[model samples]
Target: MYKKSLVFLFLVFTVCHGDIFEECEDVESESFVSSWQSCQSYVYCDGDESMLGECDEGQYFDPETSSCDDAANVKCFLDEVDEPSVEEEPEPEPTPPVMEQPTDVEIVNTAPVVKPNCPNSDDPSQVIFMANNASCADYYLCYHGHAIEMHCTNQLHFNGLTGQCDYPENVHCPLDEPSAHKCLPHITDFFPHPDKCSYFYYCIKGFLTLQQCPFYYGWDIERRSCVQLNVAKCYGNSRRA
Candidate 1:
């Protein structure tokens, strides 16, 4: 009888001190728990096992999001140890330098110019198609006197004569010019182009590429995708007259 009581107590103690694996049993699969020891480290549970994981450098495991996030956004109280206050000495002030003569230097503008509006056609109601002079793979679709930039994928170029995207060998358009636009290093998602509402930048794993929306569509910054011109509110212009 006494031996049976000891066995029951042992089982209770083991179940009470089962550590992270016991805590993970109640959580759903593929969930995370912030580590009490360090803010950067967390425990990822896959229903079968619990594994320790660490966030990237300068990042902290966010308990709210269940993912590693920027340190500025995370409030980590686990690793909040009282830091020792250090006394600092005041530094001496520096002397001012003499002014130098200014030289005349030619300043050139390297900013990308805004795309031209759709050309005026004989009938404003009729849709017009025109080839982009700067790119062979891109063209403009004029809808109701509005310029809608479009591009051809799979190395195809826009054929002005055929009014369609065709093989480069079949088209006689000018050589494509390199784009002056560049993506920001910190931004790794789809973002709208500063100069063009129809164009957006796709950045992933440090590789950057420019993309365009379809006709009567504009890049929506909030939605991170192309939406209708009426819904996008790009430059406060509507799709219809």
Candidate 2:
């Protein structure tokens, strides 16, 4: 009875493990064969002798490639019997908030200024100085009929009357004037008097000198000098006294 029981146990073990090597006998050359029991296990055949082999973790024996391959690429129904449980992935941490920058600083123009051309004039030797229309601290000097752009240092404005850069308080730029009636001290240009047709104000050396035109002539604001009475238009009073 003891011998019979041992023989039965041996038969059971052979049925379970030995069945995998049944196909290996048909393979004449040294090769691998897929096991019927488990996809992870295979049969290595060498002539008439055979042995069981296992693939690496997460791999399966592939009969087509005749080698162990990734389980995802191998098609094995037996792998479903001991499938690994799916694990849940953890949620990502929340992102931090961004901080804003302050906006209290003053914004100033830093671009290079495009130099302007000198005003049209008949007298080339006048050496005229004109204030910049865009910036009070900048001016242009007309030398030999060409304009030389210049900047005033120490935050001073170009004084047309003084023919030099001076403090902003003492300089009256022509841009600040609402009308042409006010004489600009920073320029040597002549301006017509508001109340007199024959009289005009000439800016020279930072001073306004009132001068009268010759007989039968009136101060022409457009001409910037005296002209015949018929061509000159006076804002106030008769064209001729």
Candidate 3:
């Protein structure tokens, strides 16, 4: 009975080994052995029950083909190295234009000179004076806010007396030209002069002569002589009639 029991145990172990690992004998090289068991050396499951098997070395289980392969061949990730990661590249923005500064010194411009008023007073435009007096011939013109004197041509002198331009010869004694010029004493008209008692000009023959009345006397034009203004005469004139 003991001898029979030993035989039985040997047969059981042999059968379990055979059932767990398929014989790698006909597998010509290490490649076939690894492929057959996926490099599992100790544990292997064939159908249902697990048993022991052997692999050459340095290899792991490959689930896909259900076999053992080389360390280089077995992979949990087969396409890991083969598949490249796809990444998006961003587009570059457009560059702005550059402005260049001038190196040379910039020239600053000066404002132009301007004249303040009208070009000339001689223009056809007429202007009046302080007295509201205006005439093309005798008037006042303004140049830069100043009055420019104007006059009429040839033989015409402004008659301040009559407010007209008359001959100088025509404008005679007792000059009615106006105020300070009025009541002019002349060679022809013997009039009383406030300055001397009297003073006069007389045209004798072709010669002109100056004559003065006595200190206390004045010239009387109607009498044509120097007479006493009061009751006195400084002297008697033979020329006086």
Best by TM-score: 2
Using lDDT as the measure, name the better of candidate 1 and candidate 2. Answer: 2
The regions of model 2 sitting more than 4 angstroms off are 1-178, 181-185, 236-239
Give the Å error, residue 213, model 1.
Answer: 57
Residue pairs clashing in model 1 are: none
Best by lDDT: 2
Return the lDDT, model 2, position 83: 30
Over the full model, what C-alpha lDDT does candidate 3 score relative to the true structure? 0.38
Deviation in Å, model 2, residue 82 alpha carbon: 99
Whole-structure CA lDDT of model 1? 0.56
lDDT of 2 by residue, 1-241 (tens): 0112222222222223343466676686667677754676676666435566666656677787666667888887664554334342555633333333546644533322232455565242245565566555667765444555677876566776666778766986553343754555566766667666878878775688889886456775433556665566554454344
lDDT for model 2, please.
0.58
Scored against the true structure, residue 128 in model 1 reaches a CA lDDT of: 58
Model 3 pairs in collision: 34-68, 38-67, 38-68, 39-68, 161-177, 174-184
Ranking by lDDT: 2, 1, 3
